[model samples]
Target chain A: MAPKKLGLKQRYAHMTRGLDWETTYQPMDAVFPYDTFEGIKIKDWSAWEDPFRLTMDSYWKFQAEKERKLYAVLDAFAQNNGQTGVSDGRYINVVKLFLTGVSPLEYQAHRGFAFTGRHLRGAGPRIACQMQSLDELRHLQTQIHTISHYNKFFDGIGEFPHMHDRVWYLSVPKSFFDDARAAGPFEFMIAIGFAFEYLLTNLLFVPFMSGAAYNGDMSTVTFGFSAQSDESRHMTLGIEVIKFLLEQHPDNLPIVQKWVDKWFWRGFRVLGLVAMMMDYMLPKKVMSWKEAWEIYFTEAGGSLFQDLERYGLKVPKYADVATEAAEHISHQNWAVFYQYSHAAAFHTWMPDKEHLDWLSEKYPNTFDKYYRPRWEMWAEMEKEGKRFYNPSLPQLCQVCQIPMAYTEPGDPTKIAFRCTEVAGETYHFCSDGCKDIFDAEPEKYIQSWLPVHQIFQGNCGGATVPDVLNWYRMNVGADNMDYVGSPDDRLWSEWHAAKTREAV
Target chain B: MSVTAIVPDYARRIEPRDPVENFHGNMLVYVHWEDHLSFCSAVAFPLPPAIPFGAFVSEVVAPAYAAHPEAASIDWSAVVWMIDGATKVPDMEASLAANGMKHKTLVRFWTPGLSGWKGTAS
Candidate 1:
């Protein structure tokens, strides 16, 4: 039977509980105001078209289903010897980073989405934003829940909340959120909605999901992809938000232009970790960071730039810097990851031969020349049962909180450095400008959320890896013992054994 | 919050060549709105003759575009749709290209009084 097509009011009622109180009786009294600012007149706001065919019923049902599926997986993983299934205790570093760096962004998205839900004008849009808000809230919860499973087994997860509050390394994401939260509603849409969602979302989620898949982490991939489905809707919201504002006011152009320029660079800097994870961390590499950026940013961005130029706005400054960063970010960040693993919750295993082969294929220019040799040295150490761990703390960037993986533009080897004095003690930074920024505001600088500092202060996990792992809820696996009898391995063996017995 | 590539096994390199002789630059622009009374961001990409802006936008951009708008107008067939960037879209280039839209003659304008400028007139 063909589905009955109801009128807009009836359909809306079927979708939502019912139309607003006055829909049937009250006469339309210009309840919704049109855009009057800047003197751009729209004779018809009704001309607007909603691309997403979302209704309340479908929204709730799909969301509920997604939750059911996710929890089932989580339950299985935990119940069937999931506790000991890991690559190594070293791999917890990735989760540590995920909890501290990535998970907090989930919370930020939740907050931002809530703001969008409340502020959006039309009912249809309000619904979309509300769905997105719920989606982001779920994402935050699931990411915490899934990774929390590891808190019992790893070190760095315990430090995330405290680190997010006070770690210098965490300030990268924190400041990014702070910038968004401080902006006007429209500006927030541009900064995060358009700039981050449209321009940068692919960079953030792709590598993390692929890394999860490659490392046999089913939960992260499921949750990441599940959340991303909603992100597609959010991306549309971003795109529409920009168009709607521009169409509404001719005066908004320059303000919008500056926002694009500023946010593009800001979001790009924060995504440096993503750049590394894309190019370096995944065991089964799909695309290089440079390639993803070029395809996602350049081909797509170049077209958008031309379109905007027709409208009259400059392509963002530091765009060239972003393109350049993509080229070397993988090698640089992995090096930092290798050095910092001693302090991190995750393990850092030397790149296996298969991983090296993938690197050679992905990074045709630099991997073999510079990073490959370094990995080879680590491989040799691994051969002798030694894992290389950098003894000293890395110089962290003041702005991004990441250890400065940057060198002079084009000089990959020259590490950047800066320093400042606060409370009669010299503080160090990745660049002189950062040092200057710190010196100009020592109070803000001193209040930084540095994970390493907290670790030493005995505020996290009672001064031991196990204690910290418990706090973080991490679980080390069979891979930790060279892939022999960890949960994954045991489960594999058990499943196979059962199958073999059935065969008999 | 999270971005997943829905397309299957899609991968390519972003190779930037040094300035080459006889390079004819073409551009693609896409303007999309996220929600009602929210904001519209434009994405622009500079393409050589090699890339077909229309196909990319229809196949890749439209789905993403539809996802964002409370009410979105999707013109997969309209390759060179001119968006008045000054008035309707801001930072119009990157957002368009991010969604796979493009144009031939790219101009950036910001004032509402400016006549014949597709964006806001200055």
Candidate 2:
């Protein structure tokens, strides 16, 4: 006969705390050598609380059910030829950026969580991280499986893992993860769990998922929903980690605050790529990046910092600068990509007149004044049969690795530049925030694998454009440069034409 | 020969001739240092062309220990300069124009012990 069924709280407590123990043979520090080195003083390990109170049994069962639903949708999407269902061929580039840039980051998250799970001193956070680790791995797998459907029909999606590792632009996300992973365990939690998942995730995830929904990419939407459902729990974990640290000891506040500042800016700079994707790449625009930032960061994040203010915690430094930048970064980044698309692993095209009008409406203050004129010049160039590309590579920031194209704060005329002198050498940053991060840890950033510098150093493929593209595993005409007269464009036209004929 | 004699034609074209107006007012130069294992950092300074390149290297770049702590241990007198990826600016009293330097030009500083210089494509 089976034993009496246990209640939810009892089961969760038993499942999570059952394995933890008081050390008899060895000291706790001896057993967990990795956690305390970062100087985060934990007064009581049992005081650590898991907000979800998730048991492994319930976790596996719930996750399995979600997987079943997601797999059913994935199978249906592939079986029904879902690639054709997207709004336009340009919509696929969004998926390309997601697959190449964002998906691998999930895998990195998986590894990072697993590392923290094993090393953290407390059983509470360890179990939470382990669950999130599995969740990240699942997200990575589902994202790949979903986008692999497009790989069979597209060019750029084929070699994403390789491209993520070696390509120039992909380094932004890669280096962000690498920086987090290289930090100490507590710093890792603050970096990934708190700063990334809690503070800035909505800005990253909501736009893509909503864009997927609007563009009729049902498979992506399903996967996004699945991952995002887990993200809620991760968000709780992020909040819990911050609160746990701040409440533990007074010393933890300053340390946690620094991580918040550094990771917030790092996360913000990385989201510049996403901002550009949201504004420019989507065939059917959801909301402007400015709208998303104002809603997610300004409103929600404002309330969050207010809540934390009682604990002597404050909002991230440079947050106002980031708010000011929301108007221009998307446009600036997209313009850069439009001019340099030949060097990238995805296609770019001039925003049509309607899209430009939408942009002007969305960004009334800055779009028409600064960015519109540049796009109009490019349009005239295209009309004159001279599609322009920047022959020379722009100088990249040593810390963030983005090209030094960011304009001065409040004034978009001059480039914003910040530099610091360390040990008789100079390091340049895109902004004061990035420069501050570099200054705080000169040794860490001094080892950055800047792609432009690597290319100049003869480390990337070879010396020429063809060689670099080959090294990046990109097909020249099919994958790189303008999408106007390419194979994807031709196929899209043919498919639409056939649809019209069939309707007739 | 001084760095001016060996300055590349492309760099020379961009170098400012008017020292007082250009360098003192608005001209900026970006300097970078790299070692064999990819140790690097770039610093930007609004420098006057009237100041000698050697003085800039010694007074400005050498004392910039805060940006690059690794450089503090190294001897600044031993470092060499690569201007705009081509001309090797020697340790002498050459003006910004004399070294073919202009606003926003990148100057790379390295030591003899570092790895061989990999030429940058124009």
Candidate 3:
């Protein structure tokens, strides 16, 4: 007779719990050294629950099927000359930014999860992290493969790995993951799994995917959908870890709460890049960044915190500040990028009439009153063959590494600045949130590799524009600055002109 | 305390202290109180020479805090000026220029014993 097959739940239990054994030669603490250092009290490892009930066999099967489907779409996208199908060449900058900034983060997440998976004391979270590790790695690979098609037709796509490490703007995402990676296992989980993946991932991923769909980049949309299916599982793991730690001991609540506050603001600051991309970069806009923030964060996230209320957890410390910032952050960041696009790897442009009208509609309270006039000034300059680019580098905040561009909370008219003097030397922060993070761990942040500081110190390429661009491995005229007279722009116009001739 | 008198002198003192040698110009010197959590905002102004630290606090930081909704309760006289790490600049009569402060130099106004504020420094 054939061996009896296990049922689904039994199979999950056998695959997950059965993998663990009592270690006689080495104690559990010696074996798993990372889990307890974060001060999280876990009384029983068995109390951990993998909500997906996922096993290695099922995990591999599902991911493999998803990969096959994603690759098929990517192939068709390439075969059909999908680059030409995009709404406009300007849209490619969104892909370029995604490739250079966000994809490398996926690889970093993979490494972070793999380390945590191996070291976490609980078999439940370990398996979940391990599976999520593979998922992150898959996301990185699929994104690179999908966007590499654009690299052939685009300028800024080359040297992404190097750029992610060294570029000024890319530092936002790089430093964020590095901060999480340096934390204790539990803190790392809370930072990425909960604060980033569960609470804020939709705001980052959904808009980009929908923007991809709107811009006719089907490959990105396909890969995005494929990765999002796994994101649901990652989200479950995020909430589970938070609940597990909270249930373990009452002392764990405050620690978890602080991490929630710190990581939420950190993640929100990083998404300022995404917010600008959604509101400005897409030729055909999907949804306003403010609208997405209200739906995904204010509404959905508010409910999530409400669910956790019984566990004695409150919303993050600066939730209201972030809610208010959503209305203004995209406008503020895009303006900074517009002025300093010369130093960046990606292109920036003034939004056309239709785009400006949409922004005015979406941000009626502040757009016309505060932001529209600046764009109008730039647009006026462009009309006379003059584009304004700030020749000097702006001051960078110590913690977030962004240019000091944010305004005071509840007051968009004044630039908000926060500073703390520690041990004699003063550090500047973009907001109270960043200032608080630095004050808590000054030693960690004082070592930030700020690009502007690095350049001034003669660490980046050299002192001049040519030297720095070469050092950043950027193509200068081809890869960066205003999109109006760019090679991509010229190519776009010529392609359309040829199409018009063909139709005649 | 004339605005024009302070402007040119502050520019002269602060412009040369930029850590980046290539960066030369008037830059903002940001000061904040360490003990008062409500006093987190950096009161930025051009650096001026020969201004007493006490006057700087009373005139600059105090008014800024007074404007803030939550910071009205902070005691201005009790705060100490901290600069360059652990060094305490005890002479409030000394000018910022005499004490060697520069543009973007962070001066933290700290109180010795403030209850309810979480102190991270050991």
Candidate 4:
């Protein structure tokens, strides 16, 4: 009898291709140098194999289909007057937070992917990189298109480009990439592909999707899911690249190991913002940061590190640090966000009863002991008709540009501060190395377009919240408020009355 | 091409002075791989030397290639990993051999700021 073949391969083959394929929407260009630079010798570019095989035709077809599905849901929600029906208007602040902080990141991904497609030597790797490049661009575009709908009803969505440039908070992302751009090619792979995509992406993207689902922001959920499906392929490529390098040469191990160590910490440090967003900012919270980090990083990448241990590579130097930080960052970072809400893109009211209860239940060790009292104190101020704002400017970390939320390694409460003198002026930072970076090249960091300084200097729209909100494209309680019986309230009442009559 | 015939880009008028390349890209190297955690770390700290060139590729240059997927299939030769600073490993040649690695040549260069780890040849 002839050998019987299983249906799995045939089934996958049938389902994987044809009209379902989504490829690049943009054209290609020779952006990086191949023969021009003289340092590296290339014998065979084909050795660079991309584990994720993506083509242009398939890329467009699938991507367009996904977008069509998204817009359909968005349109349905809009046509049904979903804005008025939203259970809580305050939840929109989370989306607003996402728009300013996470939205621009899509564009940054687009830029990086495009670079990979052009400069990488191997056809397979290049094509894979190219496809991801397009995927990120689509992500950026779709995110903008989807979020713009909310702009019609909210505020602060318009300030993203300016916020990205001028906001001190934005430096967390800008400087991270700046460091990578200054390195070599192999480092790029380890930093981005291995350290970031393979290890940390699940922790980042999953919370975003869950947050969207919890908050009923269908557009964000849809886009995040669609984008993450592609991330699995990117993650595969990352694993392949690291494995290939480690297996290829012994010297490569130490070099690659060092990169793994550096980038793991670099990537972990950036997650502080995400930790804050997930645990505090999202009104309808899902899992805590500690839970997500342990599953994604400690389990998946940690196992991979065990595999690499035979090849003489240490688990990322910061693995334990990241785990410990993840355990407690939620309360620390959110406290910072709560105090600074007036200056941020989103609004920060006290965590409602349910949210407070959730925190108390989820974080028993530190919530009641430390953070809850702080919010209660703020609530007292609110009762007195006063809002709490940190009047003193936060001393920015020279490297991360964050208001030094990171504490002494194990102790989460003690603030870490480092200082350096440059050009006869003493500058302060949160870490020793950051101060060194500033001191070594004062010219670079001196020109950082800090947001708080910009706002105080009147470079932003105006001095007042209402003025700035308008400039930020926010259409909230100010322009679209309903204190008693305003237009939105009257319209909402009529809609509800008709619904009640229909029910009768 | 003769050594003198090649007017090197970095060190003006160098003739075969042990060529070493760093794959650190420009413009969009650190842009992709957009996990906020990674992005923050890149900004806030001195990145470990694991993939010294990751920032170059991830943020500076990867995006251009991302813009053009159709042209991904191309070929090249020879892989060289450059370590500009210091290492605990003694005997660079033996280390290279043990690691199953080979380079056209190994050039040791001194870079300040990498204090404790600076290479012995410097």
Ranking by TM-score: 3, 2, 4, 1
Model 2 chain A: worst 10 consecutive residues (lDDT sum): A419-428
Q: Of the candidates shown, which would achieve the greatest DockQ relative to the real structure?
A: 3
Largest TM-score belongs to which candidate? 3
**lDDT tens digits, residues A1-504, model 4?**
998874754443343332232235642223344322323344444465547654465667887887888788778877876665543556566666667776676666667666765665555566776777777778778778777887776666766776665555666776676665444555566777777788888877788778778777777777776677678888987887777776666766766776677677767767777787777767667787877787888888778878878878888765776776676677666666665554565655577678888888877776675556556655665668655554333445655567655555665434454655443333446554355445544544555444443444456587565565455554555323221233334554676788799999
Could you give candidate 2's per-residue lDDT for residues B1-122 as a string of tens digits? 11111123523334322222423354557665553111112444656766887788778766653222244456666777777657574646778768787655677766655332231100
1 or 3, greater by TM-score: 3
Q: What is the TM-score of chain A in candidate 3?
A: 0.98
Score residue A171 of candidate 3 by CA lDDT: 91
| Runs in model 2 lying further than 4 Å from the true structure | B1-122
Minimal lDDT window, size 10, model 3 chain A: A386-395
TM-score of each: 0.60, 0.83, 0.83, 0.67
lDDT at residue A174 of model 1 (Cα atoms): 85
Q: Which pairs of residues clash in candidate 3, taking residues 3 or more apart in a chain or in different chains? A: A423-B84, A423-B85, A423-B86, A424-B83, A424-B84, A424-B85, A425-B84, A425-B85, B10-B47
lDDT of 3 by residue, A120-163 (tens): 97888888999899999999999989999988877899789999
The segments of candidate 4 whose C-alpha lies over 4 angstroms from its true place after superposition are A1-44, A84-87, A182-185, A419-427, A431-504, B1-122
Q: Local error of candidate 3 at A124, Å?
A: 0.7
| Candidate 3 stretches greater than 4 Å from native | B1-100, B106-122
Clashes of each: 108, 14, 9, 91
Error of 1 at A185 (Å): 2.4
Query: Compared with the true structure, what per-residue lDDT tens digits does model 4 show for residues B59-116?
Result: 4323322321111321111112332122322233243334222221111221232211
Query: Residue A25 CA error for candidate 2 (Å)?
Result: 3.7
